[model samples]
Target: MSDAPIRVLVCDDQALVRTGYVTIFSAQPDMEVVGEAGNGHEAVSAAQRLHPDVVVMDIRMPLLDGIEATRKLAGPEVVEPPKVLVVTTFNVDAYVYDAFRAGASGFLLKDSPPAELVAGIRTVARGEALLAPTVTRHLIGRFAERLRPADTARPGRADLVRALTARELEVLELIAEGLSNAEIAAALFISPETVKTYVSRILTKLGLRDRVQAVVLAYRVGLVTAAD
Candidate 1:
């Protein structure tokens, strides 16, 4: 990581909640709270003006919603976008799934421990996607039904087979299974560095931004399913 402290912007609809996030983020040595927004419109404006490295975004807000704000900040059309870490109150929120589709880099419940929140910011700042294990398992699966329709037209298993090597397909399947680099490495009897290389290759070949997209694609194409 860079020696510079990670710059952050916190956005929420409530004053007390925003302040709490500000206080928690400000206390971290490696983090700097650059700005705060009480709603999504302000979040987009603040993110554009301040250019925070990571945006701690809330889901529901007045004027605009966090999903749209995240899209404005980190959507695929953006030339260069900050990492967006979406924090919400509900674990089963469909908005969280939409946030990911809008290009959020991470997702966390508002009730997540301070340490997890801090770690989430750090992870996204490093250009890594952060989804808690439970979120990966339950949240994604819970919304699988809703996602299937939009995903039905996406590239299917045959496309994936043609586009990737057998080993790369294995790596993608393990990724969709929510395994970390170390876990995948152990499972395949390969080094973590090798797994990292495979992941990078998979992302490049598939034109995916991160593991979240990879997981989504895996499910969409029937390479893996929530049931599995």
Candidate 2:
């Protein structure tokens, strides 16, 4: 548990969705609901004013959508940005790729259990990206398939790949394949705790803030192929 509470802003066009998140997040001792917005325009404004640690955003909204809002708030254009978590109903949402491209730290289904939602927020708040295996493959592999090989090949990215130990590299490939920690552990014949440790070490060695960044790095550096 963290010493300080993580302040959060909830954004969704549906009032019920916003209210539910407020109810769930407020129950956590280490989190607080600082504000709520009904649209992307309002979300952006509220984020700027409240400066919450995390923003729970919905993709479809009036005035602006979560994708654009995420871009404005956390995109490459922003020097300093708060973490944004895309909470939506779609399992394989088309906008997910755009959300990540726009700098979202994590993506979750709206129906996700409260525990996972809380974990996602905390993970992102701590400067770690949450790439649930399914979501990662759906976004990265699918997107890469549409790109040219030359575009995927990035110079110097191989240096980061070279930095990983054999074990860590194995973990990265499994992550690219969208295997859960437990699955990766089982496949690698190691304990789940060990897999977790390797994942953390991989992120640290690669200077990646989170799993989302790791997935991006894997794709950008051509560590994982779309066919894989």
Tens digits of per-residue lDDT for model 2, 49-92: 99999999999999999999998998755767899999888766
Error of 2 at 222 (Å): 3.7
TM-score of 1: 0.85
| Pairs with backbone N, CA or C atoms under 3 Å apart (clashes), candidate 2 | 129-210
Sequence-dependent TM-score of model 2: 0.77
Per-residue lDDT for 1-228 in model 1, tens only? 279999999999999998998899899999999999998899999999999999999988999999999999988778788999999987656777888878898988899999999999988886566886556766666665465323233555347546899999999888878787888999999998899899999878876777777777777667877677
- What alpha-carbon RMSD in Å does predicted model 2 have with respect to the real structure? 3.8
TM-score of each: 0.85, 0.77
Off by over 4 Å in 2: 145-154, 177-209, 226-228
